[model samples]
Target: MDSQSAQLPIKIARIGSTVMNDFLKIPVRTEETSATALPRGAAITISGSWKGSITISSSDELSRRIAAAMFRKDDNSVEARDIADALSELTNIIAGNIKAILPGPSQLSLPMTLETVPEAAQGAVRVQLQDDQAGQLLICVQPGLH
Candidate 1:
């Protein structure tokens, strides 16, 4: 793990773990969960009401590719647009579930594409999941920053 990831707040960590456990049913080791790859890694940040960013990264490109493919539409069967839409819907459901646990009236915006950047950016708080094959769930609260 790097210095930045090590400094994540406990509250966010707890929320991340809870999201994975309750929503995704994925159990992870907290120590290993926070470790992120250096370069050519994937870090996703979902910032909105329930504040904290969660990153799921791996050195393996195959994993990411598979995830992309599975979530995309093909000519033979499902439409690529539909797959993308489904993923966004799933993100909303998970975020709503997480919001129920938090204190206050914060709403989650629908999950949008993070886009491909030259390098992954450092988010407010880092949340790395247990399974690399598993997509991440992050909801970073910015308070009254809106």
Candidate 2:
């Protein structure tokens, strides 16, 4: 495993906390749980000095809340596509930060919003976050060249 992979959990947690807080205006903290809502979020591939991908799987409630905050709308009025876009934006910010810290020549692909992570990524290391005031969001980091 590359050095970056070894420290992925901490890096992801820090990145996620900052990104979600900034964009969604919510506090995000690491927590453990196997339960996640159906239909996840985005996939961002990493290459060069280290290779892998990051995926954010979030609960429906969490998605709507984020979307609502991002667009300055009520949660009940948030659209499905907007929720996906919010997830994409969140993934982009966190992934961008992660890419910046990796050994150079490292390249980050554009965010690909996904309803479900591919089977291969199901086995990846994950960092789960809890928003005490809202729902859950999980960040999965698959280690390997894609």
Candidate 3:
């Protein structure tokens, strides 16, 4: 692993906390999880000297909660667009933060939601977190193929 790669987990945790706590206004407790089995969710790729991608996954219930929080809508009234926008924005924000600390000169792709985790995500560093009100959140950082 590259030196920067070793710092991934720490970067992820710090950025995740900042994004959730400050931007999302939600506090979370995160733990390492199996990198292989991320739940269905959205991802955004970053390409540069250090190429990799960031993915955000959560349960449907939790997604709805996030959507509500993001859009300032009631959970019961959250729309699909709200869910998609929230997840995409969350991934984008986290990826942007990570890019800053990583060996840079990188560019981020638009976020995309996937029904199944991508093959590129294999061997990714994964972290899982839960919020009392938002349910569960999974974050994965995968290095790109050289």
Candidate 4:
């Protein structure tokens, strides 16, 4: 990994802990692991001097768990919109934090949730964070393709 890529996990852990408080744990970079199939998630693109995207993804179960924590709802009570909105906000916040550390003068596009992982995310740097009770959070950072 390049120097910038190597620094991402530390920023992610710090930002996620500060933003999510007790709801999120420190994220760990998952190396030498097969890709987890993410059928649902969210992404935010960063453009300008550096262009790329930051995606936060996971299984439906984890999505709902994150939504519950974000919305203060019971896990069983999270709605589809809740999941989508929570994921979108989470992705946006992560991307924003990353943008601050990266060579900037960049712009962050509005966040969007996906029902399936995008093909462009292949080969991105990925990290995984586990919740205390149950669920996993996968964060992918893909530098822009010039």
TM-score winner between candidates 1 and 4: 4
Tens digits of per-residue lDDT, candidate 4, 1-146, equal: 88767787767656655655554432333333454647778888888988888888876777787788788888898999998998898888778887898777999999998878874456576766655544566777788764
How many collisions per candidate?
Answer: 6, 0, 0, 0
**Alpha carbon deviation, residue 44, candidate 4 (Å):** 0.9
Residue pairs with clashing backbones, model 1: 51-140, 51-141, 52-140, 52-141, 73-79, 73-80
How big is the positional error of residue 135 in model 3, measured in Å on the Cα after superposition?
Answer: 1.9
lDDT (C-alpha, whole model) for all candidates: 0.42, 0.79, 0.78, 0.73
Error of 1 at 41 (Å): 13
Candidates sorted by TM-score, best first: 3, 2, 4, 1
Could you tell me the lDDT of residue 94 within candidate 3? 85
Question: TM-score for every candidate vs. truth?
Answer: 0.43, 0.84, 0.85, 0.80
- Give the lDDT of residue 20 in candidate 3: 84
> Which residue pairs overlap in candidate 4's backbone?
none
> Candidate 4 regions off by >4 Å?
1-4, 22-35, 119-123
Give the number of colliding residue pairs in candidate 1: 6
The C-alpha RMSD in Å for every predicted model, in order, reads 7.3, 2.6, 2.4, 3.1
Lowest lDDT sum, 10 consecutive residues, model 2, at 115-124
